[model samples]
Target: MTLLLPPTSEVPVPKFNMADLTARLLAPGKPQEAQQQSSPALNPPDAPEAHEEVRERRRAYQRPAGHPSRQERAQARALAQQYRDYAEAWYQALRAWDMREVKIPYSFHYEPGESDLDFLTLGSNVRTPTRYLQTPAGEFTEGEVGVVITTMSRAPLVEQMQLGKMLDKLRHTPDTTPVSLLREDGRWHQNRERVARYAVAVLTLAVQLRDEGAEGPLRYAKAVLAGAH
Candidate 1:
């Protein structure tokens, strides 16, 4: 028996020219052209204009001749006012705490006489002077002295000014200053317990301010108390 085969339709064959392929492969521009066609351009038609708009916006936001813009000025004023509020709050807290100075005897070895020649001839001797502090808690320990002195010394300028004002208001003598105390060679150290107590007191004040709807004072109190640790 003979088997019959099905008739097939004509199919077009794709023909590749070796010379054209070789030319395309050799031509550097061909790959770039094909890439340009295959992938979209890095920048669209409106890219230049968009970039210009962004640049213009940046320029608009930039300060002129180191002078801040109105918005920036407003922001700075707000920040300064905020710090002022913090200073005021700290002052009030200190006042409320009623820190009283107590006189204590401080003995130190010092070179007697003003001149170095006198020091060389006379030698150093122990001198006892009356010292004063709000508390005598950490008067002998180096660690506490370092921590308290360092913390107080590193206080922000605004806070330092407030402290100076507080000192003056409280009629505290120069010898009662933290630096002076620190220079006394273990005469005094800031009390960590006192600091922690003050922090808690400030936190309580912050809560009270919040309850009283005093947002500014509350925020200031919170900010001031943040350095307690």
Candidate 2:
């Protein structure tokens, strides 16, 4: 049997660095420029020398070395959950849905001598080679192909809120987004792709189990993904 995923014991907790974010947030706020100007003894905030000194001071900021803070950990958890939801939505309406066989809702028959009305009378069956394709078991029966899932349909309300916020931000500025902004806003960066793939694997298993297509294939996928046989 082909394995779908590595064993759970083999899967370690995924790590991503949010240290830059923690540093910025925990850093001191901007100086009160308007108030600072009132003091004649203080150097002009915009002066190159003062700017250089401030920049050097800011660069010295360092976060404690160890596990992330409670806030940072929560941020990571929320980010992961959001990514999983996005992955689920992505696969639901993918090409597999397009390949499902179409079923006519109403039946119709040709009148009296309709032999001449057949869609095609002189057509020959085509024998195309399918050597490279893997055949899936069972024939497709038309049923729920075009389902319009409404609000809060695929996931919980909170998850929908998360997904909504995420998509909105993506619509505005997808490019030129930096890593720190991603961590602060809980958006996914190019980090830890295995978790997204793991989400896909789990969703595929769920689909197979739901359709009950074939127990043999489902068991193999489940065993590999869930570390159970």
Candidate 3:
């Protein structure tokens, strides 16, 4: 019998260039004004030049070579934690036992916004095809706010229609929507096995979240948990 192997280890992530944000916020024009203020004695002299020097200095301070300050580090930690939470939540939904027989070869990520749904592919067992879902100047499904799951491959017409209907119901209903994905042919079907698996995955995630909340993170941990809830 052949033994199954674990998934390959993900690559190392690069540190975020926090300086990019700081630079944008501290752009040149404003710095020049501040620099002119520094030397009131110089007659309407080169305020722009002064601003340039000030901006340069500000840039240097914003991104020092040494380790980040405590506050900076804390912000980084918070962002890191959010990434972790998102991953955990998705994984919980994906690994439900009910969906075991169904192929879930593709991995997907979504960010819900006021007007559009942004999709990100997280490298699935299926072919890598990334796409974005947009209203596209009012073709259809515009102004109607809810989640829409699109597959790289087409699903059965009936199952596709059912998915749309169920999604509408869930949107109107107070509870979070439950959707199931079949790996083979990348279909979105409402089969009992698929639904059960999806439900179990989400429920497990919610339970895990509650458990994490219960375990205190000291003062900082408490603050993080509070923010999450």
TM-score for each candidate, following the candidate numbering? 0.23, 0.21, 0.21
Query: Global lDDT of each model?
Result: 0.39, 0.37, 0.38
RMSD for each of the candidates: 22.5, 23.9, 27.1
Instruction: Give the candidate number with the greatest lDDT.
Output: 1
Instruction: Give per-residue CA lDDT, model 1, range 32-85, as digits (tens).
Output: 653332222232234566545444433433323345677888996777455444
Report the alpha-carbon TM-score of model 1 versus the true structure.
0.23
Task: List, residue by residue over 1-229, the lDDT tens digit for candidate 2.
Answer: 9856534432222232256445444547744642332232244344557655544433332334354767889986775545444433333323123343333333345576766666643233433322121113323322221111222134467644443333333323434222221233544334434223333333342343253433333343334335421
Candidate 2, residue 176: the lDDT equals: 26
Those runs of model 3 whose alpha carbons end farther than 4 Å from true positions after fitting are 1-70, 97-150, 153-229
What TM-score would candidate 3 get against the native? 0.21
TM-score of 2: 0.21
- 1 versus 3: better TM-score goes to: 1
Q: Determine which window of 10 residues in candidate 1 has minimal summed lDDT.
A: 180-189
Model 2 CA lDDT for position 28: 74
* lDDT for model 1: 0.39
Model 3: lDDT to the true structure: 0.38
In candidate 3, what are the lDDT values of residues 28-106, reduced to their tens digit?
A: 6676654433333332224568545545444544464465767889987776454334333343333321121223356
